[model samples]
Target: MSALRIALADDQALVRAGLRALLERQGVEIAFEADDGQALLDRLQDTPVDVVLSDIRMPGVDGIAALERLRERGDRTPVLLLTTFDDSELLLRATEAGAQGFLLKDAAPEDLHEAIVRVAGGDTLLQPVSTEPVRARYRYHADDAPRALFSEREVSVLRLMAGGYSNKEIARAMFLAEGTVKNYVSVILEKLDTRDRTRAVLKAITLRVI
Candidate 1:
Protein backbone atom coordinates (compact mmCIF):
# COMPACT_ATOMS: atom_id res chain seq x y z
CA MET A 1 0.00 0.00 0.00
CA SER A 2 1.12 3.56 -0.61
CA ALA A 3 2.16 5.51 2.46
CA LEU A 4 -0.29 8.20 3.54
CA ARG A 5 0.90 11.70 2.67
CA ILE A 6 0.39 14.28 5.43
CA ALA A 7 1.09 17.90 6.22
CA LEU A 8 1.81 19.32 9.66
CA ALA A 9 0.68 22.84 10.54
CA ASP A 10 1.50 24.21 13.97
CA ASP A 11 3.18 27.30 15.38
CA GLN A 12 5.50 25.35 17.63
CA ALA A 13 8.56 24.03 15.85
CA LEU A 14 9.20 21.36 18.46
CA VAL A 15 5.70 19.96 18.28
CA ARG A 16 5.82 19.78 14.49
CA ALA A 17 9.21 18.08 14.55
CA GLY A 18 8.16 15.52 17.13
CA LEU A 19 4.95 14.68 15.23
CA ARG A 20 6.87 14.43 11.97
CA ALA A 21 9.41 12.07 13.48
CA LEU A 22 6.72 9.94 15.06
CA LEU A 23 4.58 9.63 11.92
CA GLU A 24 7.62 9.01 9.76
CA ARG A 25 8.68 6.21 12.09
CA GLN A 26 5.28 4.65 11.50
CA GLY A 27 5.86 4.75 7.70
CA VAL A 28 3.62 7.73 6.91
CA GLU A 29 5.17 10.32 4.58
CA ILE A 30 5.48 13.93 5.67
CA ALA A 31 4.52 15.91 2.58
CA PHE A 32 5.27 19.38 3.96
CA GLU A 33 5.29 21.54 7.06
CA ALA A 34 3.87 24.97 7.90
CA ASP A 35 3.99 27.21 10.94
CA ASP A 36 0.67 28.89 10.30
CA GLY A 37 -2.62 28.44 8.46
CA GLN A 38 -1.63 30.74 5.61
CA ALA A 39 1.58 28.82 5.06
CA LEU A 40 -0.39 25.62 5.07
CA LEU A 41 -2.76 27.01 2.44
CA ASP A 42 0.16 28.03 0.25
CA ARG A 43 1.77 24.59 0.49
CA LEU A 44 -1.53 22.86 -0.14
CA GLN A 45 -1.91 24.69 -3.41
CA ASP A 46 1.14 22.87 -4.72
CA THR A 47 1.33 19.58 -2.81
CA PRO A 48 -1.03 16.65 -3.10
CA VAL A 49 -1.49 15.36 0.42
CA ASP A 50 -4.01 12.87 1.83
CA VAL A 51 -4.33 14.55 5.21
CA VAL A 52 -3.50 17.72 7.12
CA LEU A 53 -2.73 17.63 10.83
CA SER A 54 -3.16 21.12 12.25
CA ASP A 55 -3.02 22.64 15.68
CA ILE A 56 -6.28 24.33 16.54
CA ARG A 57 -4.65 27.46 17.85
CA MET A 58 -1.91 28.93 15.67
CA PRO A 59 -0.35 32.37 15.38
CA GLY A 60 -2.11 33.54 12.23
CA VAL A 61 -5.09 32.23 10.29
CA ASP A 62 -5.91 29.84 13.09
CA GLY A 63 -7.05 26.28 12.47
CA ILE A 64 -10.74 27.12 12.46
CA ALA A 65 -10.36 29.85 9.85
CA ALA A 66 -8.09 27.65 7.78
CA LEU A 67 -10.63 24.85 7.91
CA GLU A 68 -13.34 27.16 6.54
CA ARG A 69 -11.04 28.41 3.82
CA LEU A 70 -10.07 24.90 2.80
CA ARG A 71 -13.64 23.77 2.52
CA GLU A 72 -14.67 26.96 0.78
CA ARG A 73 -11.99 26.38 -1.82
CA GLY A 74 -13.28 22.86 -2.32
CA ASP A 75 -10.26 21.11 -0.84
CA ARG A 76 -11.29 17.57 0.00
CA THR A 77 -8.18 16.61 1.94
CA PRO A 78 -9.14 15.43 5.40
CA VAL A 79 -8.13 17.65 8.33
CA LEU A 80 -7.49 16.36 11.84
CA LEU A 81 -7.47 19.09 14.49
CA LEU A 82 -5.17 18.73 17.47
CA THR A 83 -6.18 21.01 20.29
CA THR A 84 -5.28 21.45 23.93
CA PHE A 85 -8.63 23.14 24.54
CA ASP A 86 -11.45 20.85 25.63
CA ASP A 87 -13.95 23.68 25.54
CA SER A 88 -17.25 22.58 24.05
CA GLU A 89 -17.66 25.85 22.18
CA LEU A 90 -14.34 25.45 20.45
CA LEU A 91 -15.08 21.86 19.61
CA LEU A 92 -18.45 22.89 18.24
CA ARG A 93 -16.94 25.58 16.07
CA ALA A 94 -14.21 23.28 14.78
CA THR A 95 -16.79 20.74 13.70
CA GLU A 96 -18.88 23.46 12.07
CA ALA A 97 -15.79 24.51 10.17
CA GLY A 98 -15.45 21.02 8.69
CA ALA A 99 -12.81 19.22 10.69
CA GLN A 100 -12.85 15.49 10.16
CA GLY A 101 -11.52 14.63 13.59
CA PHE A 102 -10.55 16.22 16.92
CA LEU A 103 -7.76 14.99 19.18
CA LEU A 104 -6.30 16.32 22.39
CA LYS A 105 -2.75 17.53 22.00
CA ASP A 106 -1.75 15.28 24.91
CA ALA A 107 -3.28 12.20 23.32
CA ALA A 108 -1.00 9.19 22.91
CA PRO A 109 0.95 8.96 19.66
CA GLU A 110 -0.87 5.75 18.82
CA ASP A 111 -4.20 7.52 19.20
CA LEU A 112 -3.04 10.30 16.92
CA HIS A 113 -1.94 7.83 14.28
CA GLU A 114 -5.23 5.96 14.54
CA ALA A 115 -7.17 9.22 14.18
CA ILE A 116 -5.27 10.21 11.07
CA VAL A 117 -5.94 6.84 9.45
CA ARG A 118 -9.60 6.97 10.35
CA VAL A 119 -10.05 10.52 9.01
CA ALA A 120 -8.20 9.62 5.81
CA GLY A 121 -10.65 6.76 5.41
CA GLY A 122 -13.57 9.22 5.73
CA ASP A 123 -14.50 8.56 9.33
CA THR A 124 -14.98 11.03 12.20
CA LEU A 125 -12.84 10.72 15.34
CA LEU A 126 -13.58 12.51 18.61
CA GLN A 127 -12.02 11.92 22.01
CA PRO A 128 -14.52 10.51 24.50
CA VAL A 129 -13.74 12.84 27.38
CA SER A 130 -13.56 15.70 24.98
CA THR A 131 -17.16 15.17 23.96
CA GLU A 132 -18.72 14.18 27.31
CA PRO A 133 -18.69 17.52 29.02
CA VAL A 134 -20.13 19.17 25.93
CA ARG A 135 -22.92 16.65 25.95
CA ALA A 136 -23.57 17.11 29.64
CA ARG A 137 -23.65 20.85 29.28
CA TYR A 138 -26.29 20.51 26.61
CA ARG A 139 -28.35 18.04 28.60
CA TYR A 140 -28.21 20.29 31.65
CA HIS A 141 -29.89 23.07 29.68
CA ALA A 142 -32.61 20.95 28.06
CA ASP A 143 -35.42 23.26 29.02
CA ASP A 144 -34.75 25.81 26.29
CA ALA A 145 -36.94 25.97 23.20
CA PRO A 146 -36.16 23.37 20.54
CA ARG A 147 -34.41 24.13 17.29
CA ALA A 148 -36.89 23.78 14.40
CA LEU A 149 -34.68 21.70 12.14
CA PHE A 150 -34.15 18.18 13.47
CA SER A 151 -36.74 15.43 13.39
CA GLU A 152 -37.35 13.12 16.33
CA ARG A 153 -35.18 10.36 14.88
CA GLU A 154 -32.41 12.80 14.02
CA VAL A 155 -32.47 14.15 17.56
CA SER A 156 -32.28 10.58 18.85
CA VAL A 157 -29.27 9.90 16.64
CA LEU A 158 -27.56 13.10 17.78
CA ARG A 159 -28.06 12.14 21.44
CA LEU A 160 -26.46 8.77 20.77
CA MET A 161 -23.69 10.53 18.89
CA ALA A 162 -23.02 12.82 21.87
CA GLY A 163 -22.66 9.58 23.80
CA GLY A 164 -19.82 8.66 21.43
CA TYR A 165 -21.31 5.70 19.63
CA SER A 166 -20.15 4.72 16.15
CA ASN A 167 -22.61 4.51 13.30
CA LYS A 168 -22.69 0.74 13.50
CA GLU A 169 -23.22 0.86 17.23
CA ILE A 170 -25.95 3.44 16.78
CA ALA A 171 -27.67 1.23 14.22
CA ARG A 172 -27.63 -1.69 16.60
CA ALA A 173 -28.90 0.34 19.51
CA MET A 174 -31.65 2.02 17.52
CA PHE A 175 -32.64 -1.16 15.67
CA LEU A 176 -32.12 0.46 12.31
CA ALA A 177 -29.92 -0.50 9.38
CA GLU A 178 -26.52 1.14 9.35
CA GLY A 179 -27.32 2.93 6.11
CA THR A 180 -30.46 4.35 7.61
CA VAL A 181 -28.52 5.57 10.57
CA LYS A 182 -25.99 7.26 8.32
CA ASN A 183 -28.77 8.90 6.37
CA TYR A 184 -30.25 10.28 9.56
CA VAL A 185 -26.90 11.69 10.50
CA SER A 186 -26.46 13.31 7.10
CA VAL A 187 -29.87 14.93 7.34
CA ILE A 188 -29.14 16.07 10.82
CA LEU A 189 -25.97 17.78 9.68
CA GLU A 190 -27.78 19.54 6.86
CA LYS A 191 -30.54 20.75 9.09
CA LEU A 192 -28.18 21.93 11.78
CA ASP A 193 -26.00 23.70 9.19
CA THR A 194 -22.90 21.98 10.45
CA ARG A 195 -20.25 19.71 9.08
CA ASP A 196 -19.51 16.19 10.49
CA ARG A 197 -20.99 14.38 13.47
CA THR A 198 -19.25 16.14 16.33
CA ARG A 199 -20.49 19.58 15.34
CA ALA A 200 -23.95 18.24 14.71
CA VAL A 201 -24.13 16.84 18.21
CA LEU A 202 -22.78 20.02 19.73
CA LYS A 203 -25.21 22.15 17.75
CA ALA A 204 -28.09 19.95 18.78
CA ILE A 205 -27.22 20.46 22.42
CA THR A 206 -26.68 24.18 21.97
CA LEU A 207 -30.03 24.45 20.26
CA ARG A 208 -31.74 22.34 22.91
CA VAL A 209 -32.87 19.78 20.34
CA ILE A 210 -31.42 16.91 22.34
Candidate 2:
Protein backbone atom coordinates (compact mmCIF):
# COMPACT_ATOMS: atom_id res chain seq x y z
CA MET A 1 0.00 0.00 0.00
CA SER A 2 1.16 3.53 -0.65
CA ALA A 3 2.11 5.66 2.35
CA LEU A 4 -0.39 8.36 3.28
CA ARG A 5 0.80 11.75 2.08
CA ILE A 6 0.23 14.40 4.76
CA ALA A 7 0.70 18.14 5.20
CA LEU A 8 1.34 19.72 8.58
CA ALA A 9 0.05 23.26 9.23
CA ASP A 10 1.03 24.90 12.45
CA ASP A 11 2.50 28.29 13.33
CA GLN A 12 5.02 26.84 15.79
CA ALA A 13 8.11 25.46 14.09
CA LEU A 14 8.99 23.20 17.03
CA VAL A 15 5.54 21.63 17.11
CA ARG A 16 5.57 20.95 13.38
CA ALA A 17 9.04 19.41 13.61
CA GLY A 18 8.02 17.16 16.51
CA LEU A 19 4.92 15.94 14.72
CA ARG A 20 6.82 15.39 11.50
CA ALA A 21 9.37 13.27 13.33
CA LEU A 22 6.67 11.16 14.93
CA LEU A 23 4.72 10.60 11.69
CA GLU A 24 7.89 9.81 9.79
CA ARG A 25 8.76 7.17 12.39
CA GLN A 26 5.37 5.57 11.66
CA GLY A 27 6.10 5.37 7.91
CA VAL A 28 3.74 8.15 6.85
CA GLU A 29 5.11 10.52 4.21
CA ILE A 30 5.26 14.23 4.99
CA ALA A 31 4.32 15.79 1.67
CA PHE A 32 4.92 19.35 2.86
CA GLU A 33 4.69 21.57 5.88
CA ALA A 34 3.20 25.05 6.27
CA ASP A 35 3.49 27.76 8.89
CA ASP A 36 -0.11 28.87 8.54
CA GLY A 37 -3.41 28.05 6.79
CA GLN A 38 -2.77 30.19 3.71
CA ALA A 39 0.56 28.51 3.24
CA LEU A 40 -1.17 25.18 3.60
CA LEU A 41 -3.71 26.08 0.89
CA ASP A 42 -0.94 27.26 -1.40
CA ARG A 43 0.95 24.00 -0.93
CA LEU A 44 -2.19 21.94 -1.58
CA GLN A 45 -2.78 23.65 -4.90
CA ASP A 46 0.45 22.17 -6.19
CA THR A 47 1.16 19.06 -4.10
CA PRO A 48 -2.18 17.16 -3.82
CA VAL A 49 -1.53 15.66 -0.41
CA ASP A 50 -3.84 12.91 0.91
CA VAL A 51 -4.57 14.48 4.27
CA VAL A 52 -3.94 17.61 6.33
CA LEU A 53 -3.14 17.74 10.05
CA SER A 54 -3.59 21.31 11.12
CA ASP A 55 -3.53 23.35 14.29
CA ILE A 56 -6.85 25.13 15.02
CA ARG A 57 -5.28 28.52 15.75
CA MET A 58 -2.74 29.78 13.20
CA PRO A 59 -1.65 33.30 12.17
CA GLY A 60 -3.88 33.89 9.10
CA VAL A 61 -6.80 31.76 7.97
CA ASP A 62 -6.92 29.50 11.02
CA GLY A 63 -7.61 25.79 10.58
CA ILE A 64 -11.41 26.19 10.70
CA ALA A 65 -11.35 28.99 8.16
CA ALA A 66 -8.97 27.03 5.97
CA LEU A 67 -11.26 24.01 5.97
CA GLU A 68 -14.21 26.26 5.14
CA ARG A 69 -12.36 27.76 2.22
CA LEU A 70 -11.32 24.34 0.98
CA ARG A 71 -14.92 23.16 1.07
CA GLU A 72 -16.02 26.27 -0.75
CA ARG A 73 -13.44 25.47 -3.43
CA GLY A 74 -14.65 21.81 -3.59
CA ASP A 75 -11.47 20.31 -2.22
CA ARG A 76 -12.25 16.87 -0.79
CA THR A 77 -8.91 16.09 0.91
CA PRO A 78 -9.44 14.79 4.41
CA VAL A 79 -8.53 17.13 7.29
CA LEU A 80 -7.70 16.14 10.85
CA LEU A 81 -7.72 19.06 13.25
CA LEU A 82 -4.91 18.75 15.79
CA THR A 83 -5.24 21.41 18.42
CA THR A 84 -5.49 22.14 22.16
CA PHE A 85 -8.74 24.05 21.88
CA ASP A 86 -11.44 21.59 23.03
CA ASP A 87 -14.19 24.08 23.60
CA SER A 88 -17.61 22.71 22.60
CA GLU A 89 -18.44 25.59 20.29
CA LEU A 90 -15.09 25.37 18.57
CA LEU A 91 -15.53 21.65 18.05
CA LEU A 92 -19.02 22.17 16.64
CA ARG A 93 -17.80 24.89 14.31
CA ALA A 94 -14.92 22.75 13.10
CA THR A 95 -17.28 19.92 12.21
CA GLU A 96 -19.58 22.38 10.51
CA ALA A 97 -16.63 23.63 8.47
CA GLY A 98 -16.04 20.11 7.04
CA ALA A 99 -13.27 18.74 9.25
CA GLN A 100 -13.05 14.93 9.05
CA GLY A 101 -11.53 14.38 12.47
CA PHE A 102 -10.35 16.16 15.61
CA LEU A 103 -7.62 15.33 18.11
CA LEU A 104 -6.20 17.08 21.10
CA LYS A 105 -2.66 18.45 20.88
CA ASP A 106 -1.69 16.33 23.91
CA ALA A 107 -2.93 13.05 22.39
CA ALA A 108 -0.46 10.18 22.19
CA PRO A 109 1.52 9.81 18.98
CA GLU A 110 -0.15 6.46 18.33
CA ASP A 111 -3.58 8.03 18.74
CA LEU A 112 -2.69 10.81 16.34
CA HIS A 113 -1.45 8.34 13.76
CA GLU A 114 -4.60 6.28 14.10
CA ALA A 115 -6.74 9.36 13.71
CA ILE A 116 -4.97 10.30 10.50
CA VAL A 117 -5.37 6.81 9.10
CA ARG A 118 -9.03 6.70 10.05
CA VAL A 119 -9.68 10.09 8.48
CA ALA A 120 -7.96 9.01 5.31
CA GLY A 121 -10.23 5.97 5.29
CA GLY A 122 -13.30 8.25 5.41
CA ASP A 123 -14.02 7.97 9.12
CA THR A 124 -14.47 10.67 11.71
CA LEU A 125 -12.82 10.89 15.12
CA LEU A 126 -13.61 13.25 17.96
CA GLN A 127 -12.37 13.54 21.52
CA PRO A 128 -14.83 12.13 24.07
CA VAL A 129 -15.47 15.55 25.60
CA SER A 130 -16.14 17.02 22.20
CA THR A 131 -18.59 14.26 21.31
CA GLU A 132 -20.34 14.52 24.64
CA PRO A 133 -21.15 18.14 24.10
CA VAL A 134 -22.78 17.27 20.79
CA ARG A 135 -24.84 14.50 22.33
CA ALA A 136 -25.84 16.54 25.35
CA ARG A 137 -26.97 19.46 23.29
CA TYR A 138 -29.59 17.44 21.40
CA ARG A 139 -33.05 18.86 22.01
CA TYR A 140 -36.20 16.99 21.04
CA HIS A 141 -39.30 18.88 20.01
CA ALA A 142 -42.98 18.09 20.68
CA ASP A 143 -43.96 14.43 20.43
CA ASP A 144 -47.36 14.77 18.78
CA ALA A 145 -46.27 16.87 15.82
CA PRO A 146 -45.77 15.34 12.39
CA ARG A 147 -42.57 15.79 10.38
CA ALA A 148 -44.02 17.46 7.27
CA LEU A 149 -40.93 18.42 5.32
CA PHE A 150 -39.55 14.97 4.42
CA SER A 151 -40.72 11.82 2.68
CA GLU A 152 -40.65 8.48 4.51
CA ARG A 153 -37.33 7.58 2.90
CA GLU A 154 -35.84 10.95 3.77
CA VAL A 155 -37.00 10.56 7.34
CA SER A 156 -35.26 7.19 7.56
CA VAL A 157 -32.06 8.74 6.30
CA LEU A 158 -32.40 11.61 8.75
CA ARG A 159 -32.83 9.23 11.70
CA LEU A 160 -29.70 7.38 10.69
CA MET A 161 -27.93 10.69 10.34
CA ALA A 162 -29.07 11.63 13.84
CA GLY A 163 -27.47 8.40 15.04
CA GLY A 164 -24.22 9.60 13.42
CA TYR A 165 -24.15 7.34 10.40
CA SER A 166 -22.09 8.58 7.47
CA ASN A 167 -23.46 8.64 3.94
CA LYS A 168 -21.79 5.34 3.03
CA GLU A 169 -23.16 3.62 6.08
CA ILE A 170 -26.59 5.01 5.47
CA ALA A 171 -26.47 3.76 1.90
CA ARG A 172 -25.52 0.27 3.00
CA ALA A 173 -28.19 0.20 5.68
CA MET A 174 -30.94 1.49 3.42
CA PHE A 175 -29.92 -0.59 0.38
CA LEU A 176 -29.43 2.54 -1.71
CA ALA A 177 -26.54 3.61 -3.85
CA GLU A 178 -23.96 5.87 -2.21
CA GLY A 179 -24.74 8.63 -4.68
CA THR A 180 -28.41 8.47 -3.82
CA VAL A 181 -27.53 8.67 -0.14
CA LYS A 182 -25.39 11.69 -0.85
CA ASN A 183 -28.25 13.36 -2.64
CA TYR A 184 -30.60 12.66 0.26
CA VAL A 185 -28.05 14.10 2.66
CA SER A 186 -27.62 17.18 0.52
CA VAL A 187 -31.36 17.72 0.37
CA ILE A 188 -31.58 17.20 4.12
CA LEU A 189 -28.86 19.77 4.74
CA GLU A 190 -30.60 22.26 2.48
CA LYS A 191 -33.99 21.78 4.08
CA LEU A 192 -32.47 22.01 7.57
CA ASP A 193 -30.17 24.93 6.79
CA THR A 194 -27.06 23.18 8.11
CA ARG A 195 -23.57 23.45 6.69
CA ASP A 196 -22.60 19.82 7.42
CA ARG A 197 -23.86 16.44 8.52
CA THR A 198 -23.26 16.84 12.23
CA ARG A 199 -25.18 20.08 12.50
CA ALA A 200 -27.95 18.68 10.33
CA VAL A 201 -28.34 15.76 12.72
CA LEU A 202 -28.43 18.06 15.73
CA LYS A 203 -30.98 20.30 14.11
CA ALA A 204 -33.20 17.38 13.10
CA ILE A 205 -33.16 15.97 16.60
CA THR A 206 -33.84 19.39 18.10
CA LEU A 207 -36.90 20.02 15.97
CA ARG A 208 -38.16 16.42 16.38
CA VAL A 209 -38.06 16.14 12.63
CA ILE A 210 -36.39 12.75 12.53
Query: Worst lDDT window (10 residues) for model 2?
Result: 139-148
Report the alpha-carbon TM-score of model 2 versus the true structure: 0.67
Candidate 2, residues 1-210, lDDT tens digits: the string is 999999999999999999999999999999999999999998898899889999988887899999999999999999998766444546667877888877888888898888788789887665322444544565434552333478899989987775446788889999999999999888888877667777676566556565
| Candidate 1 local distance difference test against the native | 0.80
- Best candidate, TM-score-wise? 1
User: For every model in order, what is the number of clashing pairs?
Assistant: 0, 0
Residue 191 CA displacement from its true place in model 1, Å: 13
Model 1: residue 16 alpha-carbon error in angstroms: 0.8
lDDT of each: 0.80, 0.80
Candidate 1 similarity to native, TM-score: 0.73
TM-score of each: 0.73, 0.67
